[model samples]
Target: MYKHLLVAVDGSHTSENALDHAIGLAQGENAELTLVNVANPTEYMALAPEFLQHESYEAAALSEGNSVLDEAMKKALASLPAEKVHRHLLVANKGVKEMAQLLVDYADEQKTDIIILGTHGRSGLMHLLMGSFAETVMRETNLPLLIIRSDGEA
Candidate 1:
């Protein structure tokens, strides 16, 4: 009987799978879904990018990030009514605390009842190598979280 669901998405295949699952669940459970995309924080990109100084890649990358969030919103909203879905693109160019806290803050402001995330599914040798955003998210908050594995597995 959840009314509000906050979903963290990145526009990756894993995020797409999670979006489909979130939408389906929202449809079945009659809940509202919020699609969230976090921009590659400026911190991740050098302010004066070496590439920008030396090449054209920096501008291209910025353009790509701008398009990505909008594209994610379009794809996520395609599944539901405008009234039942909310889209957010946040830029936290710093620590995981900022990222996690911003989502948590948004959820609190929206009165969210749950959080849905698509796990990228880096496991075994790869899992240990890469860690997981979901794992970090899971550790940081008490919000109800639904972690969906990316497609292709059982």
Candidate 2:
């Protein structure tokens, strides 16, 4: 029953699963699909009191992130209907901490009916280091979320 579906991807296998699921649903429902990737602004990492900014590192990371996302999108769209797929790349620090909310904002802007994403299934130390970006997104955003977990479990 979805009219517009938005899939938030990060080039991970879990995200690929989510993309696939979203695509299948879109194809079945004849819905439009939009893929989004948020490039976290690298400036915040250099916010320490004494450290100078690392321009080169940030630039390189941005470039790499964009390239990876582009490739992932290409792969995801290869088997999907051409007229139904759309893509957007955004750079915002808000996404890093509020991925679900960020997706919801984008969906609201696009009037999308659903948001799809892959859950990395991380816990303990790993989650402590990177935190659950997806969980935060899910908690803060206000949209129907279809989350596919890694290990092809969900």
Candidate 3:
């Protein structure tokens, strides 16, 4: 049984599905839920022009991350008490570490019993080009992972 569950959300449909699944699992086990949204400033900086300031890009990323966490928290509050749910907004440097690594590190820090995430199920060229965060997390972390595929089901 999972005592502490961590669900990562990015405001995508797949992530919503994953949150639903996490909610069900947490409710069944009476587990504490932590909703995590990670903002990588380097991602925006990579696409930014030379004149763009790093601080401005990081601020925008942080704002977006907070919005994503707020939306996810609303859904969580519907099923769990506000006190039972915790929210974290993480800012990671993409140049130093990937999102999967950051998620894993946070899970370790929180002592999470399980990790839940959604996968878009991209394969072939698309998979290669975009990379799979879920796959990377599963490979890197030793904890149990429940991955919900994007198939219009929760």
Candidate 4:
């Protein structure tokens, strides 16, 4: 029933699984597929203080985001036609919004019927500290979500 589907890819194996699922769903419904990646320069800078150079960090983040989107587009192309699949790379605004919010907002902006994402499956203290992007997206959006866990749990 979905006419358009949005899948978030972070170049992880879990996201690969989610992309596979999205491809199947898109094929079954004859829907358009949009693959999105959000790059946060602040994150890379914070994690690697030695980088120190703002330009390098921003370049790295954007490069990584494009790489992720390109890889996902290649994979999706193998299953879906080039015309049916699209890609978007978003740069996160530091301190302005969380990644989950960015994903949700993008999905809405694209008018996607459903959102598909993979969960890292962190739990307990780790879950509390890292938080769950899938959970946050679900809470932030009113659209339908298909969350695939790292261990094949849905």
Candidate 5:
């Protein structure tokens, strides 16, 4: 029933699972698929300057993000036409916004019917420390969300 499907991909197995579900949904519903990857350079901001400079960190992050998108696109093309699939490489604004917020805003901007995210399903201590992007988006967005977990433990 979706017209536009938005999926977050990070080149992880969890992300791959999410993408597979998105692709199946898009094919079954004849919807357009949008793949998004957000590269947040802020993760490295706390590192020593000598270890990784600002420019280098951002460049590496963007490069990796692009690679992730490219691979996802390749997989998508196997089942969907190039014209029906789209990809966006997003860079998180340092200190201004978090990655989850960026994804929510982009979904709003695109008027996507649903957001599909893959969760590592971390719990307890790890969950508290790293937090959950899927959970955050679920709390902030009004749209439908499909969460695919990498493991069943969660």
Candidate 6:
């Protein structure tokens, strides 16, 4: 019985599945849905200075983030009315862990009843290297979380 649901999307297939699930839950419960996309500042900061300047990198990241949010909004609107869906783009200047915290903080600000997100399901070396925002969020937040694996593994 969620009143406000927050779904994090990154234009990936996994996130798309999560969005679909969130939409279904929202429709069934007559709840409001919010779609969030986080832009990691570390990505831009990692780029070589000669290859790309910081200002340009930030601009590109923001643009891509907006595009992801727009695409997610279109898919969400197919299942729910525009009035029932909200969109948010968060800039995570610190890092992945901070990104997870930002999501939690945003959920608090929005008074979201539940958070829905998809896991890429990376394991072993890849998992170790890439880390997981979903895992971090789960560990840090007290709010209810629904995690959907990309390949239906969970």
Query: Which model scores highest in TM-score?
Result: 6
Tens-place lDDT digits, model 1, residues 1-154: 8898888877678777877788888888888888776654444355556545424443444455556657766765777777887777666665555777777778778889888888867789876775677887787778888999877752
Lowest summed-lDDT stretch of 10 residues in model 6?
A: 51-60
What is each predicted model's overall lDDT from 0 to 1?
A: 0.73, 0.75, 0.88, 0.88, 0.89, 0.89
lDDT of 3 at 125: 100
Q: 1-154 in candidate 4: lDDT tens per residue?
A: 9999999999988898999999999999999999999888876766656655446777888888998998999889998988999999888856324888998999999999999999888889998886787888888999999998897453
Model 5 stretches astray by more than 4 angstroms: 45-55, 94-97, 152-154
| Per-prediction TM-score | 0.76, 0.78, 0.89, 0.90, 0.89, 0.90
Model 6 Cα lDDT, one tens digit per residue, 21-129? 9999999998999999998756876777787743676676787789999998888899898899999999887777999999999999999999999999889998899
- lDDT (C-alpha) at residue 144 in model 2: 81
Worst 10 residues of 2 by lDDT: 49-58
Q: Assess the local accuracy of residue 116 in candidate 2 as a C-alpha lDDT between 0 and 100.
A: 85
- What are the runs in model 2 whose C-alpha is more than 4 Å off? 43-58, 98-100, 152-154
| Deviation in Å, model 5, residue 72 alpha carbon | 0.3
Any idea how many clashes model 2 has? Answer: 1
Winner on lDDT between 4 and 5 is 5
lDDT of 5 by residue, 71-122 (tens): 9999999999889899998888553237888899999999999999899988
Q: Which residue pairs in model 5 clash with each other? A: none
Better of 1 and 4 by TM-score: 4
What would you estimate as the lDDT of candidate 6? Answer: 0.89
Count clashes in each candidate, considering only residues at least 3 apart in sequence or on different chains: 0, 1, 0, 0, 0, 0
Q: Which pairs of residues collide in model 2? A: 100-137
Ten contiguous residues with the weakest lDDT in model 4 = 45-54
Off by over 4 Å in 1: 42-66, 124-129, 152-154
lDDT tens digits by residue: candidate 2, 1-154: 8989998877778887888898889888889889887766564465663453346545544665677678766865776767788888766655367544566688889999988888888889998887886788777777887878898454
**lDDT value for candidate 1?**
0.73
The better-scoring model by TM-score among 3 and 6 is 6
